[model samples]
Every structure is written in C-alpha cells, then in structure tokens.
Target: MGNCCVAGASSDMATFKWSIDNFSSLLDKGEGWTNSRVFKIMGHAWHLKLNPMDRNSCDEECVSLRLQLSKTSVEPNTIVDASFRLIIYDQLYGKDSEHHVSHTFQTASTSSGKSCMIKLAALKNSSGFLVNNNCVFGVKFIKVVTTKAKTTSEKLFVKNASTLPEAKAAYTWCIADFFGMENPGYSPEFTAGGYKWSIRLDKEENHISLYLKKMINDLPEDSAVLVEFTLSIKNQEGGKHLKKKGLTQFSNNDPTWGWEKVVSMEDIQDSSNGYLIKTKCCIEAEVTTVGSSKMK
Candidate 1:
C-alpha cells in the first residue's frame, strides 16, 4: 500500500504562513493591532473536531491574549528618561509574534516647566529578511520637558492713610498690640510720616467693601466716619445703675460737638456694657491688619 500524506501537514504550514501574513498586515496598518481576534483548536492524535468563529468566541480569546501580553510586556510605573528606547515582544512565541506590532518606545526628555512626547518603533531584523514585509513602524514626538514647581509670594500689606494722634493711639494699643501677640505675621511700623501695618486679604466682596478699609490705615476721600461713643452713668452714691440713670444721649444738638444723631436704643442690657462701639463719624481713617498666608 502507498503511504498516505498527512492531511494537515500542508494546510498547517499554509495556515502558519497566513498567520504571519496577517501579522505583517497589522504592522502596515499603523503601529498597533486594530483589534485582536481569537480562534480555538481541537485536533488530537486521531479524533477530529470543528472550531467555530463568533462574536463571543472572538471576545473571549482576544481578552485572554491581551491579558497575557500585558502581564509580560511592560512593568508598571517604569521611570524612563528622555530619549530612552523600549522593546515589546509577544510572549506567546519567543520569536517575534506573527503580529508586527511595535513592542518598544523611546521617551522624550523635557525641561522643568515643559511637556514631552514618546515615540514608538517596530522590531526588525538587520538582514533584508523582513524589509518591505510590513515588519516595522515608527512614531514621532513633539515637545518633551520635565515638570516644574509653582512659585508664589508671601502676603504684603500697604499703608493707605496718614496717621493721626488718636488713630495711632487706638491702633498701637488696641489693634497692633492685640494682633502682634495673637498674629505675629502682621507687621506694624511707625515713622515720622505715619504708622503703617500690613495684612493679607483676599479678593472677596465682603472683604473689599467692609473689612478692607477698616483693616488698612487709609480711608476713601468721600468716605463717611463711624465711631463708638459710650455713655457712663454713675450715681452720687457711688453705685452705677442703668434703670435709675435712664438713657444717655449724644446727637447733632450737642453744643460741644454734634455731627451724628443717636436716634434710639431698643435693646438695653444693664451689664457693664463696656463694649467698643462703632458709629459713622465725619472723620474717617483706613485701618489694616495682616492676615494669614494664602499659600500655606
């Protein structure tokens, strides 16, 4: 009897060639695989089987191959310097896989405050063996630079108005003394021209409108004055009482000085009431105090 030629030997060789051709095609289509495809094998020593192709089968096979590739291809968090080379290889076969996809890239270098790009290239043999067979791919990089640290300045306060005797006394004793101990960042200085202090204030509507002027040592030209006037009621018997003394009044009708009108007092408390009150007066001064550092 004449010896029978193996049924799959020729076809298997042809299929292998086809697989290589498909891989070459991938390299030509760009640097990477467009998508992965999978297949099943069922051919033992004697028993025969048929493999089918479908969406589910393809997805399962592709995912498995990709997982294998990812595990063996690259290390996580690999710090690459500028202009360094990379090499990717198919783990399934020691030889370059049938897919000509690039397995390596070069990282570009950049300056402290600039950006950089990475380039990729396909694997190839020096011999004319794989030339013109879609065995290589390449990519270009544009900008490459290192990251930079941001720079900022500390808070600075500027003087806004000339210092007066009363204003200076109030600031030195009440504001300066109080804040100097509590907040050392605040810089309070006095010179022949005037006393000046610095405070950090952000750009907020409430801060700008209400607190800004009061915190600084200057007032606007058309600014109205605000003052806190306290009335002390003492009886001849040496006891002080608000109910017996009744209400204290200061108004524009006063002979000594009269610019503001104390309309009324609704809530009355008999307590010490030694509160530093604030009222609008004709004379106004800008007050400023250093705030906390914005960066920290």
Candidate 2:
C-alpha cells in the first residue's frame, strides 16, 4: 500500500500526488491498494484510488486509477459535473503521461476515471517513471461545474393596456455650413414626455438619410416607447418641404429608427428646387404621438 499527499485545493481546481515508496515490492507482491486524503473543491469533497494490479483488467501488467467523492462529505441526491486529468510523472525525464476525461458524479459511490491508466511493465521499463524505489502518480481537477435551480414568476398588470395617453412635440435644427459639414450631423437634444430625443442626418448613396434616436442612458432596463413622427428637409426658398412619416417602437436594443433615402441628392443639389441655399439647410422632426406606460 502507498500514501497520497494533497498538494493544493481550490474552488475550480486541485492537485494531489501519490507515492509508492517500495516499487519493487509492489510489483512482486501485486494486487496492492492506495488512496488519498479527502480534498474539498467547490463545496465538494473528493479523493483518488489506485490499484497496482488491476483485477478488472485482462492484462496483468495494467493498473487502475479512479477519482471518487468522499462518502462522508457528500449530501443525499447530490450531483457533480467535473473534468480531470490523471498523470504519471517521470522523475528523471520531463516526459509525463496523462489521461483526461469528464464525468457526472450522482452518488457517493459514483466515481470518474480510467480503468487502465498504464501498464506496470511500462512504468518499470521507463527510466524516468521509476527512480530507485519511488514512483509518483497525480490527479488534477480541471473543472467543476455547479448548477443552481431557481423558481419564481413575475407579471405586470396594467388596468388599460391599450388606452394609454399620447404626447406630441416638435423640434427644428438649422445647419449653417451644410455643404462643408461632416457626413453625419446631429441635432440638439430635446425632451418629449419622459424621454429625451435627437435627430441624426447622414449622406447616403446620392441621397439624404435621417433617423430619430431615443436617449436611453437615464431609462431603466426593458423600458420601451411607441412613437409616431415625421422627418422633413425644409425648402430654404419657401417652397414645399420634403417629408417622411414613420411609426415604431423604441427600446434599448433598437434606439434609433429612420429612412436611408429620405430625399434624393439631386433634389438638394438642384438650385431650382430651393432645398439648399447659401451653404445652409434646415431639418425638422414632429413627434405626433408618444405612448407611455404607468406602473401600479
């Protein structure tokens, strides 16, 4: 029989070493047993078992190694998900042999490991494995997965889900250097109901792109607002303005909504249309309806 020394133990990983002091005697006597001390990891206790001459193997030269839960430390009906590595160290050479596997331990007796870790003949033949009368076997817990089951439910009851009141507002922004400005332009922030809003303007392939953005930094998670609005490019020469109407829901994930082609670039470039004049342009947003929610 041999003894094991627990090197270190942690929540996610642990290591231990088993030493056979009299290697020649174990090989000659055969059928020897060894086990390690209890080691706790992630609130679970574990230990290792080694057999010098595995009775379960057809080949007499083979050995068996297993990782088991400490029966005294485990609770009834407890389950553990884990992965580990069994290692045979070479004392002389740096070449080490290892076997890795995963298992689900459902009971106190349930164990996970290799039945045939290595052959005793190979261990004796290798110079690095067996030095003098000493041999080393090791185990490393690579992962320990813990699962928690929670049970609960929540519901928000609104007295009138479809009859909430609507709010309306409008804002207009003027850009002095329209032609010399950047590709994307932003309007000043405005308040509408409980939320702040802004307008974004960009140049799309030969057209103008406009979007309405809902500021969500101050809002709580899962908050959403339904809005109906109009985006327009004002005709600087006092002609009819070009406009697009839209209706959409605004949430954290989808904070902005708009059209890529609100008005063609040809219309703005043409002097006869009067959409742009003296390097200046105007943009307007009319939030016609904003649906809000009330919590009880």
Candidate 3:
C-alpha cells in the first residue's frame, strides 16, 4: 500500500524527531509495529510530564490557566452578551474536561473593566471564578465559545426642581442630594435648571435628612411648586469618569421631603469605596393667598 510519513519534533523533545505513517497492511496481519516506533508514538502523545521534587518545585510547575474574550471598544453602561467554552486536558489521563462560562458585558462605570454590571453565570467550578484586582479568570483551556453583543437602556433619576408662581404661601420643594453621600453640594450656578436656590446644608452628618422652609412670601396657601434636579455620586479615586445613574422617591410622611433609603442605593455602581444616594421629591402644590400683604 502507498504510504506517506509526516515528521516533526515532539513538543517538549526538540532534540528528538518522530513520524506518523499509514500502516494498515501491518495492522491487518495482527502484528504490532516495531518497539522503536511505539516508543516514538508514546513520546509524541506526552512530550513532557511535569515533575515536582519539593514545595518550591510544585509551585513552579503548577499550571495556571485563563481565558479572555477579544477586546472591544464599548460605550459606558452598554450591555453586551458574552459566552465561552474551555477544555481542560489532563495529560496524564489523556482525557479532556469541558467547562462553559458566560457573562453580559457592561462598560466599566468606574475603573476600566475593574467592575462589570452584568452578573456572570455558567461556571463549571464556582471556586475557580474570581474577580480579584479587576481580573476575571476561568480554569483550563478555552475553546468553541460564542458571545452576542447587546445594548440595553437603564433609567436613572437625575435630580429635582420646583417652580412657584409669583404669589407663594409655603413653597415647599423636595430636592434629593445624591452626590456621594459624603460630599453633597449645591452647584455654584443652577445650570442644571429651573431654580435660583441655595443649599440649606452642604452635607448630611448622620442619617439622610431633609428640612423644609418657605423660599418666597406673598402668604398664599398651597401654591403650585415644581421641583427637579439631578442625582450624582463620585466614582473611586481613579474612576471619576464613569457615569452613574440615580433614582429618587418621595418619603412617606413628608411628601415634600425626599431622602434615599440606604438599602435601595446598594447597586448604583461597583464602588470600591463610596456612598450612594437617591433623589427624593414631591409633586407640585396649588397656591392660595392667606395674608393681605403684597411685598413684591
């Protein structure tokens, strides 16, 4: 029978060469190949076997594996679907263990890829999955995987504003301060819109607090007042560029008073160290004149 031999060096034994050739006629005779040929085949299968003589040797020989998706430029807060497959080949047994892992991609809100908004699922070994120092890892070799990129929109409450008519009774406007619970501030210019206002207090010392006061006077009862603004929180020291979404709801007792509950602010962003806050507010009120004094 016609035969062709393919020759190459073993992966670990560059000094030694080997070959594979068709040998159907010899196999049909119920006879094995020569011993030298068998040895060469064995060498081809396992060119190198790790050896550990001590703890240090074991550490040095231990194989650490990782898999990563091709890098792409993504916009902030954009959601992407990603999936991957990995094959762990145990050379000693000449067998492969298959693993599947997947994640939805979200642009880093802070610290480039340091944190992801999507929750990762489909891991074969739970303990092997880690998000240490912004590095994501999977065990063994990665192969035959697929990912779909998708974009999703999330609604974030920015802030609150209040507009009152010329005649005002008690112009009670609710504004939520979501500026990094630690360093809340009123901007120098009300560029955000709808009001010429002053901050009652810069920061809330303890629990989130809000106080109500009359901004204007004509002594009217229940004047229509509109409140609107944006809520924001600073990212980690180096992640100041990530944009965060904010939401606010009116507190129960004081409809005109707004304060974010601590628990609700948990997932605002993947923050290394910082406080999250919400924008709270109330609906507009109708005005009625109470005192007979026109001071304007």
Candidate 4:
C-alpha cells in the first residue's frame, strides 16, 4: 500500500491516499473479504473499504466503495458531525473520476459513513484507473466550525440628570479651590449597566478634573463592572462641545474614569468660547455599564 497527504486552506481538512497492488486479485475476493484501511483524520478514525466488483449483486461490471468513521471514544452513541468525499482515482491520465453521489455526514444521521459504487467497465473504458495492475484511492474530510452569537449591553439616561432616579450627589468641589484639595469630592450617584456609578469634579491647579466613580457602599466585595460612556463639556453659548468616549472595567479599588482637565482654566474663563454662561458651566454624560465576569 502507498500513502499520500493533501493540504487545504483550513488546517481542519484531512486528505488520505492509498495505493493497491495486484488490484485484480483483490476484486476477486468478492464479499468474502473487503480491502479496507483505518486512518485518522480530523481527530477521528475512519474506515475505507473497496470491492473490485459486485458480481453477487447481479452486476459483475460494478465496483463498490465504503467510507465510515470508527466508533467514537466520546459518550456512547455520540453524534459526530462530518463532511467528506471518496474517490477512485484514475492515475494513468491524471483525470480524477468523481463518483458524484452523496458525501455529507451530519449529526442527525442514523449511520456514520457513506458508500458508493461505479461500473468497472466505465472506469476501465475511460483511462488511467486500472493500469499495470495498480491503482490509487483517496478520501477527503472537511472540518466544521461553529460560532455563537455576540451579545452587547446598552443604556439610556434622562436628559435631566438632576431627576435621575438612582442618582446621588456624585461629587462637589469648590470650583476655584485648588491647593488644599488632595482627593475627589463627594459624587452624585446613579446606576447603569448593573453597577452604581458616580461623577466627581476633582480640584486641580489651572484645570477642573472630572471622574466617574463606582459606588461601593452597597456593592459586594471584589465586584467588577464594565463601563462605556461619553463625557462632554457642553458649551451653553454654542454647541461645539469637548467630548471623550471610553470603555473600561471598574473594580472596588479603581472605580473612577474621567478627564483630568476637561477644559483648560484659560478656556473655561474665555467669554467667547461659550464655556461659561454667567459663571455657570454645563457638563453632560451618556453611559452604559454592565456586570462582567470575563474581560478581553
């Protein structure tokens, strides 16, 4: 016997070739014996059997071939899905004779393999298949790949943040105070995505910093949340806003995210920039957060 391998685009495909000597004598075995070989492909074992002629089936001119997967090591009677093809190659002229019948193997099947037959007279009458008493046979099995549907989380907040149902005063800092402030102030709290969130204005020199805080008051220990949001410094005079978008996970110890300098102190104080409306500034946030056990 001879062996050969064929490569396909996906690493999943397995192709095998077998050569036979004294080809005519093997066919004379009839139903008494079948020429078969066990081979591994796509992580499973399969059987390929060939009969030279079907003289017992009232058709001496026909030949038979079978392709079957070995009993699996998986659970008893496990359903193994597969797709494959079997061919009796005509090596003399390089023309491969496709049996052209059925070759699909699936889970819902009652059997594990497929069998095909062709007229020996047609094969011989063609060319190159049975030459010098030697012939080649081959089988190709395809790998099936499956993927799950992707899921995404989303949220919406009322335009009036002051009336937000789960909101608390996330943070407040004396706008003009800088030197003595070392930490974020008390924040306004709200819930989105499966976690509590807060917004804080940190007092910093020359700039007003902001942050979204993960509220831990009622949170379970080691809790984590995935947060996605867009924060904007809305210009009350004009709509040319300063905006930022981000996605990150917030854990108990690191629950905040925001701009360190939302707008420069110089930009904030500029009258023509639409940033200060009679000394009052406008801030806006659109957020979506979720409870996530795995992150990528």
List the global CA lDDT of all models.
0.23, 0.75, 0.28, 0.59
Tell me the number of clashing residue pairs for each predicted model: 28, 0, 21, 11
Q: What is the lDDT of residue 159 in candidate 3?
A: 23
Off by over 4 Å in 1: 1-24, 27-83, 86-287, 294-296
**Alpha-carbon RMSD of each model:** 22.8, 11.4, 21.3, 14.3
Candidate 3 per-residue C-alpha lDDT over 195-286 given as tens digits, one digit per residue, 9 for 90 to 100:
23333323433333332222333223332232332223333343442222222222222223233432233343335433322343221222
TM-score of each: 0.18, 0.45, 0.24, 0.40
Tens-digit per-residue lDDT, 85-183, candidate 4: 677787866777554334334334423333445577775565588777777777766653223334444432223434334642221212223333346
Q: Point out the worst 10-residue segment of candidate 4 by lDDT.
A: 168-177
Residue 268 displacement in candidate 3 (angstroms): 34
lDDT of 1 at 154: 44
Per-residue lDDT for 1-296 in model 2, tens only? Answer: 46676755744567778878887786677686667767666567787777777754465667778888778655555567788888878887778778897887765446775557778777767788888878888888888775542333333333353554453477888889887777798888987655788999998768889999987665456555667789888888888888889977677778899998777888888888777887788888887434533222
Candidate 3: which stretches are off by over 4 Å?
Answer: 1-62, 72-79, 109-296
Number of the top-ranking candidate, with TM-score as the measure? 2
TM-score of 1: 0.18
Q: Judge candidate 4 at residue 63 and give its lDDT.
A: 65
* lDDT for residue 156 in candidate 1, whole number 0-100: 27
* Better lDDT candidate (3, 4): 4
Candidate 2 residue runs with Cα over 4 Å from true position: 1-3, 55-60, 148-296
